[model samples]
Structures are given as structure tokens and as C-alpha cells.
Target: MSKQNFVIGLTFVIGLIVGGLAIAVWPAPPLSTPAGHALSLRVPKNRQLLDIAISPDHSLLAYTAITDGRTRLFLRPLNRFEATEVTGSIGAAQPFFSPDGTSIGFFSNGFLKTTSLYSDGATPITICAVPGTPAGAAWRADGLIVFAGPGATGLREVAATGGTPVMLTTIDQDAGETSHGWPSIINDRFLLFTVGKHGYDPRLTLLDLETKDTRPLLLADGGGFVVTPSTLVFARRGELFAHHLNSKTLKATTPKNPF
Candidate 1:
């Protein structure tokens, strides 16, 4: 088998027990990993980090840090650097930078407001276009911003500067399957989100802008996917997954469970 195929085959398993907040889903079965291990890092004790954003050039990473009823944004250089608290005591999470690297976007409003990042510690400009809680910002390559929100379908999108947001999912759904995880961008024109269901399972879907279609990538837990310059890295169940953007091949990336 090709290395990429082997990577996908051994990356992640969709069916495993996470066990939190009444976690339950349709059994997708456990997948195995034969490839080498993907690197892993533990979230700081008592501080739950979520919605990680790696820069397009892969130079830095930003994510939300929450604990003790407080939330803030953190940043870390990818190479041999400890993560630093970027904004302390700010009710911010789910951060994404603009295409030009001059600005960042994250939800600041307790009700999910989009705020732009600036260097001079200036007040963040609220982008009235998108309404969100935590999972409210995704920066596209062209500087267009998309975010998940509450509306007819529990998610919406707007531009970076601000304007009328077009709902991504036509069907009404919960914001997250578990614990309000943010929507992940699959590519420039596509994204991945979940539709919550009771007594059944949350639906993992890929959103296509051109077709206005949300394709099912998995049943309940196919949410997190990181896009490197050349590949897309994801984790599922007890393993990791990768899809090469250049070759357009899907593979398992981790030797063990990344989640």
C-alpha cells in the first residue's frame, strides 16, 4: 500500500468511547493505525483548550484556553516554544487570523461576537455580520471570514469586514454535538460541522459553498481537521487521519489515538 493510504488506514478510528457530557453516538466501529504516531500534547491541567488554529504558513498556532469560568486566547510558535498567553482575562476563544497575517478573528461576546485582533491593543472591531458563541470564526485564503452561529440552522457566516451572513446549513441543528466545539474549515470553499440529534447521533458534514450542500463525512465525530500547507490532518476515535491536498489522498496519520 502507498504511504498515504497506509496513513489513512492507520490514522484514526471513528468508534471509540470519549465519555463526557453523556457522550453517545452511533457505533462506527474502531479503526486501526499501522502508520507512525502523530505528535501529541496534553492540554494544561484545568485549562481546556479548544478550536486550535494553525497559521497558513504553519509558523504559529492559536487556540482558546478556558478554565475556572474564564476564557482567553493563547499563541505558540510551532518550533520549540512554549505556548504563551496572548490575551489574558479576555472572554475570547476560537481564534483565526486573517489571510494577510495582520489581524485575527475570535468570538468575544458571551453570546458569540466576532472580534478582530490588533497589535496596538486597540479595541477590537466587532464584525456585526456574524453572530456566534465560541466557534464563530474561520478565515479563508481570500480573507473571507466564515463562522458558525445560531439561527435557522445554528450556524452562519459573514465576510471579514462585516456584512449580511449567509447561513451555511439550511437545516436547523445544534451548535455542537458535545461541549460546543467550533466548526472546522476543510478547505477554502468547504467546512466541517455537526448536526446534533437526540437518541440517534450527531451528523458530521462537509459544507460545499458552490452547491450549498453539506456532505456527510462521518456519522457523529468527524469534526477536527488541520490543514497543513500540503496535507490535511485530522483525528478520530483513538487514531489520527490525514488527507493530502496536493495528491488528494486520504490516509491515517497517527500510530495511536490523537484524541
Candidate 2:
């Protein structure tokens, strides 16, 4: 991989797990070095967490930090030495970058909003009105944003420019899934998300965007996942793992000593 691609892939794979706590980014199981370890990223002034994200170009890092009982968004240039406040207000969480990485989408005060990295103030995109909270979200290459629906209503999608989010799939209550969230776009046609109750083990579900069909992908136990060009990384039972994936089908293949 080129230096730029390496940075983007690394950020996506690691940022998936930086919610609500201080954490370290590990090499994708396949990329483990001889020492089988990776360097740590120290987040500054981090008290409580909401979410974190990286731009497509791997130039910027955005995250939410709680301090003085108030939540705010922070941004830092990966090549720079310090972080700075991006959003002057509280309530922003679940930050995601636009496809081109020029703007950021987030959930604040029960609504979906976006703010330009070069401008000021967040603009409301949609009134999701999700009860409790929306579980997870992702931005598509074709300008669509997919997010977890209110309660157990499965997943929903809306235009990146803003509109009513339409239901993307139906939830199967009989499957023992309490709700679905943490959606990550696997490719142009597929998405991966988490489904389960708070105390129960959560599994990853793959959604076919074209057919709206859903199937179990893996047991994540309510953790996060990411799909890179040559591997699939996921978290389960507090451990992170990577497995070989058929590039075309995006399905797991036999394990190869990852990396």
C-alpha cells in the first residue's frame, strides 16, 4: 500500500473502536509486525468519549471529548502536533466524514447534522428523533448516509444533503436481536452492523444494499468492525481479530497467519 492508503486504512480500522474510552490502535491481525504490536495514539484532554473519525485522505482526525461537564468536537491534523476544538458547542457524537472528507456528519440533540471543516456552526440535516439514541451510521460513496433507526426499527438511509430517512431493512424480533447499530460500509453494495441487547452477545450483520437482504456475518459481541481491501477486522469478547476475505464475495476464507 502507498503511504496515503496505509494511513486511511489504518485510521478506519482503528477508529471503529475508540468510543467512550481511551484506547490504542492495533495493527490489523494480518499486518502484525515481528513484535506483533503497534504504537499508541494518545488523545489529549480526553475525559469522556462519544466517537472519533478520520478523513478519507487520512489528513485529519475528529473526535468528541467531554470536559467540564460539556461535550465538544475536536480536530487535529495528523501531521500536526496538537488538537483543536472544531465544534464550539456540546451534544455532538458519532462523528463521520463525508465521502470526500470535506464535511462531517454527526448526531446531536436527537438530530443528524453536518458542519464543514473549513466553515463554522453545524447545520441540521435530519430530525432522526430516534428514541434513546441511534446506534451507528455510515456515509456511502454515492452520497447516501445509512444509520440505525429509532428503537428496533432496523436501519435507515437518507441523502447526504438531508431528507427523511427511509427504512433500509426490517428487523426480525424472533432472531433474538434487540436492536441494530454501528453500521460500516463494507463496499458499494454491502454494510456491516451490530445486533443484540445490552448484556447479550452481539453479532455482525451484513446488509446487501441492492436487495435489502440481511445475513449474519460474525459474532462481534457488541464491538466494532472494518473491511479493508484485503482483510476484515472485528472485535469480539474484548479481543480484536482479522481474517482473510474473498475480495470478490467479501466472505471469510480460511485463516492465513494474518500478516
Candidate 3:
């Protein structure tokens, strides 16, 4: 099968702490080893972790860290204790894995770029220029990437290889909507994102990729992800919450509960 046709099957967990750096991975229950035990990774006193993402198969991790006054991306296998820096990933932030876990996508120097994880002397490939710092991005199985760009007011779609981006969603200024960001691809035709304004009020929203329609799912303070086909997870006030999601209708089937 083609790489673009690959589907990611692992759960995505993100941990971000401002001013300090600590990374913990808590695998879901019922594994060969006991669950809920966090595997913490620490950085040196001089370096600081900024953002992180897990590979699709959960065997590797990609994170952005400040080292030598430059923000760069690093890769760490779960079985290893140290992470190696990606050479051409200076200024990289918000790193994410490709669907097949062979490359990583990140924002650097006002552009979205990708780099191979295993190639020798591979340089970062520039996908497209973004207006401002991106809020978040997700790679879809169909070879398209959706990201929130340019003040995070709307969503934009660009090919994974490289191309000009087209607007996907328009913010409803009259409805007090200020920005739309943190996109998670549910499938080829639907997306989960967050809608926010000046204050901390954020709503989990669902967008139809085919029709360009949107629907509010719940009140969430951060990005939401479909952990499973029937479950959605998000955060509110630093606490995680889960909901029974009807993926077909893109609606929450149950009330929010602590995750």
C-alpha cells in the first residue's frame, strides 16, 4: 500500500507545560505492563522542552526543545534514554508525525516543513509559508494537511508534499468567534478543532471537509482528539475530559466526564 493510504492507529497524547519541562507518557489500561504509570523524561538544566508528539505506532517520540538558544526537534525511541536532534529542524515547534511514522512535520521560521526520520543527511522540505505561528496541525490519510494559521482565525488546507494553501473555515466574527485552531483529523472528510476568543472560553467544534460546514461539539479549553472510533478526549481548565462520540454524526453522545 502507498504511504498516503496508511492509517494511524495509536492514541495521541500531548503534554505542554509553560516555563518548565517534563514529559510523561501514560499508556491506556490493559497492556502487558500495568497502565497509569507515567514514564517521565527529563532534559538537562540548560535545555527546555516546548512541545511533543508520539509516533503513530507509539514506538517513538518527537519533541521540540530549546538548545543552545535555538529551538529544534528531537527524536527518541521509547526503548532509548536519550534523544537525538534533527539537524535541519532549527526553530521547529509543534512537531507531529506523519501517518506512516516515517517523517515529522513542524513549524519553523514562519513556514511549515517536514523532514525524514531515517534518511541520511536529509534536509527539511518546505511545505508552505504560514501567516503566523500555527496553533496546531494534523496530517490526513489522503495526503492533505489541515492547520490553523495567520492569527489562528481560520483553518487552511495544503498538500503534505508542498503547495499553496486554501482557506477551509471562516471565523464568524458576529458570533463572538475570534479564532479557530488545534485541528485533529477524524477521517478524510471530517475534522475536530477548537474555537476560541479573547478569553479562555473554547469550544470543541466539528468541521465537514466536504461541505465546509461546522458544528459545535462541546465546551473545551484546548484541542480535542478522537482517541478511539467511539470516544473523544479534550481538556478544560487543565483537566482532561472524555465523551462518547458518534463519529458518524460528529456529535457527542454522552455528557463530558473526567478522563
Clashes of each: 14, 3, 0
So what's the TM-score on candidate 3?
A: 0.83
What are the RMSDs of all candidates, in order? 10.4, 7.2, 7.5
Candidate 1, residues 1-259, lDDT tens digits: the string is 5533432233222111111001234334326622222223356787865555655544556666677777777766645347766643277755766765566677766433334345444556666633443444567776566666653354666766767667555554353333223465655666666655545554555667667765555443335454343444444443454454443422223323233
lDDT for 54 (candidate 2): 70
Best by TM-score: 3
Q: Rank the candidates by TM-score, best first.
A: 3, 2, 1
Q: Candidate 2: TM-score?
A: 0.78
For TM-score, candidate 2 versus 3, the one ahead is: 3
The candidate that wins on lDDT is: 3
Q: In model 3, which regions exceed 4 Å deviation?
A: 1-38, 198-200, 254-259
lDDT of 3 by residue, 1-259 (tens): 3211111111123332110122364334445633342345666777777777877766777777788999988888766778898979999987878889888899999999988887775899999998566788999888888888857378888999999998888888887888998888786678888898666578988888778778888887668767567767776655666678876776686564564
TM-score for candidate 1, please give it. Answer: 0.60
Summing lDDT over every window of 10 consecutive residues in candidate 3, give the lowest-scoring window.
2-11
